[model samples]
Target chain A: MDTRPDSGHVLSADRPGRFGPYGGRYVPEALIAALDELDREYAAAKQDPAFTAELDHLLTTYTGRPTPITEAARFGAEAAGGARVLLKREDLNHTGSHKINNVLGQALLTKRIGKPRVIAETGAGQHGVATATAAALMGLECVIYMGEEDTRRQALNVARMRLLGATVVPVTTGSRTLKDAINEALRDWVTNVATTNYVFGTVAGPHPFPTLVRDLQRIIGVEARQQVLDLTGKLPDAVAACVGGGSNAIGIFHAFIDDPEVALYGFEAGGDGVATGRHAATITAGSPGVLHGARSYLLQDEMGQTIESHSISAGLDYPGVGPEHAWLKDSGRATYEPVDDADAMEAFRLLCRTEGIIPAIESSHALAGARRLGERLGPEATILVNLSGRGDKDVDTAATWFGLMDDSESEGGR
Target chain B: MTTSVAFEKARAEGRAALVGYLPAGYPSVDGSIEAIRAMVEAGVDVVEVGLPYSDPLIDGPVIQTAVDAALRAGTTTKDVLRVVEAVAATGAPAVVMSYWNPLDRYGAAAFARDLAAAGGSGVITPDLTPDADDTWIPAAREHGLDTVFLVAPSSTEERIAMTTAACRGFVYATSVMGVTGTREQVGDAAAGLVARTKATTQLPVAVGLGVSNAAQAAEIAAYADGVVVGSAFVRRLLEAPDPAAGVTAVAELAADLAGGVRTR
Candidate 1:
């Protein structure tokens, strides 16, 4: 029977891992037992003080959690309608991104499941690098799947993952990008489930993943909330983050779902523009369909073939969005908008010049959206943006875009 | 005329039914039809016309390569139905095995109606589960088409029972814990999974995935009601020098598999 809409499945009630009509196990039956075991493990992990203490110790000593919030005064006054913009400095964390938050949790869960190896699929390789790092830390065997095209485009991250002692398999099937990488990773998981854990990187996959990753990454908002209060004496008027598969956005937004006054804005990658039909603006331009694992908004053709998504930011170039964002958008708890490649680059350059903080291009979408939201909410509003990662991984793309790198350097002929 | 009729006739002969799968428009829409026709003529009891999808996560490299070729050749939902129509014209029970999206995109009710009108028997969803589904069951039910759901080796007793209850034509036991590919040996878990599935429902239980040879087919047929072979047939076409050769190769393989089922 079709039940009524899920009333905030995560914090409100113990849902069957559903967010309204979105998010369910739309996977093959083979993984159901594993998913159930993961669900049970995560639930128990949440209650067990030993697990929590160990995770907390890792977060503090190893991951350097409870990251600080910096006020972007110069960038705010110049670009954002003079609104107070506060940046949640997830960039400064050990792996240089908020991805470490969830990766560490799943790596721990992988160990708890008694599986000694982990496999992960990556788009731009942020999650892949993070997963590789955690696997190395835990002394577990790790394998990373990246699309062939992406492996060439993101060679440095490939190097990083390799340096961390993970095998990098270049997937040649399908579009040979993030989508195909995920497909290959799922195939690997199905074959090696008895010994390996598919360390899902985002909140977009089936069942417990959307819920599980969110629960692990929610510390972004959980910590941001208290940190913002301790600094500002009151909650911010709004929260903003970039949405690809929407792990970081969902991570930052979960703690704010109950705060009705705080408007949540997710910035989708508008490659050229949504109107031009070349963008990854799933929530803005997509119809609800199944992709990856969960039923969510996706770029699909009339016959349901997944249309390739485009974005200058490789991390944000995904056809399907997290199911929670779909639910949040439909339920009117959040608003999603597209930021064109040019606008995001403009913001990317602006943040580096004004705040001396180079943000991930994926996070640049959120920064660009905040400027728009600041204009809408006016100067009186306080906006907290989750700078999900540092820009070190994105320097090459940024250098080429801004013409900072000459042709010879980019071409590698010199 | 239907899966039940075909399967029952095979059962009456004291042999497990041979099920063959070939994706629509693999070489071309017409060439795909020819391959399945060869399969049926060579003694494949049931024809499973695969509807190629953009994201085929349940498939291995062999099927994925074939599906990609089909998509590149402009295989559409309509072409898949056309293939089904051609296979059914042979008086063989034909079913379209597809992922959920294309059918969902074509409108589940509409696709079901189109398939029924096409003289098709049912759909076999590799991804969609009975519990996860909302629209497909009703649409298939309305069109008098069977909804075949898979029961994996890792499926719990509760899930197996629920999956079988929601299934109509026959249950697809995924035999292995992984996607579609021919393994060196059939997983030992297949027989136990089939026996467990049989205890729950009277519907014939067909074993799919990793069955590459007649020996493997015979092994599965010893316990299963039907032996489903896909990648092996697709691999022949993938490696064929010519379309006609692919059809002949598929026919040869199908005949060999058919023999294996009977001997068992």
Candidate 2:
């Protein structure tokens, strides 16, 4: 009966069903049995020392944890107005993003739960690529749904996922994008309820998902918080991260939510501009509604139907925010702002030029927000920006956007 | 009399009926009301007033957009119920088609009583089953409203029998394997499903999903007692932009489909 001796590390015995004000089982009746099974398995796995040791080995050898908290001295000097800037350097993580942390944990959990097939929905394809990588390493059958448009734009990532032995399904419904991919994935899950474990990529979805992903990803904040404090002698004036379903933001901000001295800001993508009816600023312009299995801030019509959302960054190009992020916005625990495509692109280029760090276009939204906050805080404020991912994956898009590639030439090759 | 008694009579008389669907206040609340009025005037046997939720998983693009417009227009469950009451005042048979959460939130039993009192004849929770039927069905029957059940082509023989036994007004047979509002033609597959459902139950089996036009409706009516066309009507409403005109247009279409029914 006591099968889960390995789960002691992740879930605290004191608070077995909570993650701050977030996380709980808020799904439908049909998923109750599967969720209960998962909860039990997860509990047992945390208590298993062997499971912990193996996971630790993967974190060290595979994911490259204790990722450097590098001082972006030159970039910081300019951004600080005199204050220092510290990068959590999650960009250095394998697969070049913090997305791997959650993917690896879930892949391990998938095996523990005895599920042979893993499914995920991808927008920017970072999470898809990460999930595909984990599945190939563990040899689980993997299926990833990407928007048809994203499949084309992020072709290399599609190839990457295929190379990792995952089936890449191009979702061609609704907007033929991320939201539709989510719809298709949910339908797949409902159909394959008995045989599959959906490796949800971010801190979103119904109940346990937002909690599960945060717990898996908390390592980033746990390490970064300590690393930053040790290096700076105090908490930074502000913490900034981009909001694509708010995973990385929550990962970093959860540790500092109770820190009264630190201000947390989440940057949303304002595509062309908020007024142009094009943007993914759900927290800023949306209301609470059920989407992708959870009640969250969603861009929707009054009848509760999902509305078309736009964002220059493909990862942030979704119509709904994670449920906890909605709660945070409603409760005023965090402030969210929209950074337009132009500003984010400028910041993307600026960071590359000044710090030699090419961040994902999604991460550049955070950098754009940091620049504004830096101006407001004025020379006396230190900001810890979560350089959440590297930009190699986005190079082709960046090249075209910046006109670095010839208009007539096909520019996908590395 | 119970709504189920009416369905039994309809089935016995060998007279297939029509059930029209419209989002509450789609073009506008008034437009939706006019559509219902037209449906009643146009001889619709039943009207399914949809309580729009944000994400309708089983719906195609057209109905989804209609729902979006309705929600944008500030339509709520309470507002939809008011629309139901308004339609009921016209003496048209009304059924509320909705997801379970809103019904659960409103207290299923309480909702049943209020809806029955307000002139609604039936309740169709699209996602519920007989085993899980206790959540709303008993309360609905207690309040004198019929609790309809749905069966798809994928339903097992055992499931069809179970659903037929538990069903009240009529059994709704989803003709296709996909969502509502799809333009995929309703083929012989739907006809086959209707025949199968008929074998399982003495109750009238109404075919929905992919029954977009009068031709499809006539085709479906050949096998089933009735055909449910949601997206086609919603599409008309979407195009006309005026709710009354949209309803009249759909009512005309419904009449055309009803005219095509041929009994053996």
Candidate 3:
């Protein structure tokens, strides 16, 4: 049973939700019926023109769809042979990130399923903000579980979610991080399955979720493919996005999978460095294991205990990546590279200084990877980078990292 | 004795079997074995020796805390088998309850062979369902080991049939829709799930998850072939200040549960 679909572009096939033995519903029995219902409703919703039209209308009118692509001439000057860098401006979207794309679609599905309450887990708070925003618009009660440690670091997003009337629960369980938050959220979903929907943030989790989130996010590449052609007169030489749970990268990669010439690259967070054993580069430096519902590349010890992953960017600080990314890696359709925290920060600073665009630290890993890739491909090459989000929510952490704000000021502000 | 034999004997005695759970190496590896042996002596028909895993997703906070302590104390699969071998020597059936990852990592076929050799009766895999047991079920069957799968309150009738068909020694009917924990009241859904599972298979239906006190055990015993309790036992040992006291606490609780299961 090699369950990998023949076409990489297809979301799923008849193989029961597996992406070549990687993705499957590895959840408790309590969630199976809910996941099956979601699978059935999603299959129906895909065929319904009314559902498609409503989603399109919401994406266009509310989310500001077809975000523009900017050519980064100054940023590309440092390339070995003056390559061209094109930026897909997902940062310009509502909620300042590509997370809104998946949230809106799942929120619609949540409403269609008549679930009045939605629960989500957050690491960096971007997904929580987006989920809260959609829940507010739809008048659904939203509960966002965040680790106690993340709440302290990402305090601003907590306030933003609360402002949107989303309850923020600080999880104090195992390791007090993203994984724990997901555990708590799963528990909540199991307990309140009748009234609530779990809005998984990434292209991970059980069956339909990996496929569904990717379909929602494919708009990034769908819009970027045309935008790049309209700007460059042809397709770019490569497409790149950062991979935490790999939602944004898969979103952009799906549309370009059939474009043989356009190479796909995913940048994983290399916290200190893979050599130092303090990184979230799951695909680059991990083995296949199950975590957070899906069997993907995971950072686990020999005893099958999940190891804590470290990254300067909380969004990329996850132990497991999406199963699709693992499939793509094995198929040789996509190249995954590790970008260290220092390198990503350098690229983050360079983008701000040269192009006046502040990228989310999560996205900066891709920028750093793009720079290295561009230098290899030379001047005639065009590379498109998915700039996943703005840096506004991360300013306090960034200021502290760069020593831009005094310790007293940072402490007092929080 | 085999798990089936233990259940048969309990049926002959006109009582629902009392299954007790204790994570190996919680306070220490030897200490846990002693505690479980005491439970068997106190009249537990079946003992489920928990192999501690780092991510026990199906478990509640109490079991999670105990399992965490077990893992921190350096419990491994080898250590787990040692505890099972010792517990099985007590003339009661001893089954290993574990999440699937550790067994997968340890190699499923090898685990089956090792457990059977160690005199362990079977396994209760909380996370591995019927659909996902392609490798494990076949391997367990080859080694003559009992394979227990869980059916939950949320499970549809079709799913209940599918799960019970795949089960061997017994069908574990999760009493609630949530993770493993003790509640003041047994979920009303437990009886319906037990009935549904019973309709599907002749295998004994054991109700677990949230059965804490003797009264709840007695209520479940009226319908189910077995009453399984995990978190309550873990809580008893966890609140104990020392291993000697923990063993006494587990023995006392097991005696009470044993009394509750005697329907005749």
Reference-based TM-score of each model = 0.96, 0.72, 0.97
Off by over 4 Å in 2: A1-29, A406-414, B1-54, B59-92, B99-264
**Of candidates 3 and 1, the better by DockQ:** 1
Please state the CAPRI-style docking class of candidate 2.
incorrect
> Distance from true position, residue A285, model 1, in Å?
0.6
Evaluated at residue A246, the lDDT of candidate 3 is 96
Please provide, for model 2 over A180-292, each residue's C-alpha lDDT reduced to its tens digit, 9 standing for 90 to 100.
88877776765565678888888777656777777777777778889888987898889899998888998888777778688889999998898887899988888755566
- Candidate 1 lDDT score relative to the true structure: 0.91
- Model 3 lDDT vs. the true structure? 0.89
RMSD for each model, in Å, please?
A: 3.3, 7.6, 3.1
For every prediction, compared with the true complex, DockQ reads 0.86, 0.13, 0.70
Please report, as a residue range, the 10-residue window in candidate 2 chain B with the lowest summed lDDT.
B1-10
- lDDT tens digits, residue span A1-414, model 3: 011233544334546768887888777788899999999988888878888888888888999987999989989986314789999999999999999999988899999999999999999999999999999999999999998988998899999999999999998877788888888898889888999999999998888789888888988988899999887799999998999999999988888898889999999999999999999999999998888777789998887788888998989988889999999998899999999998898888888888999999999999999999888998888999999999998888778777777645542221
> Best by lDDT, which number?
1
Off by over 4 Å in 1: A1-15, A407-414
User: Which model scores highest in DockQ?
Assistant: 1
TM-score of chain A of 2: 0.91
Error of 2 at A24 (Å): 7.2
Query: Per-residue lDDT tens digits of candidate 1, residues B79-168?
Result: 999999999999999999999889888999899999999999999998899888689999999999989999988899999999999999
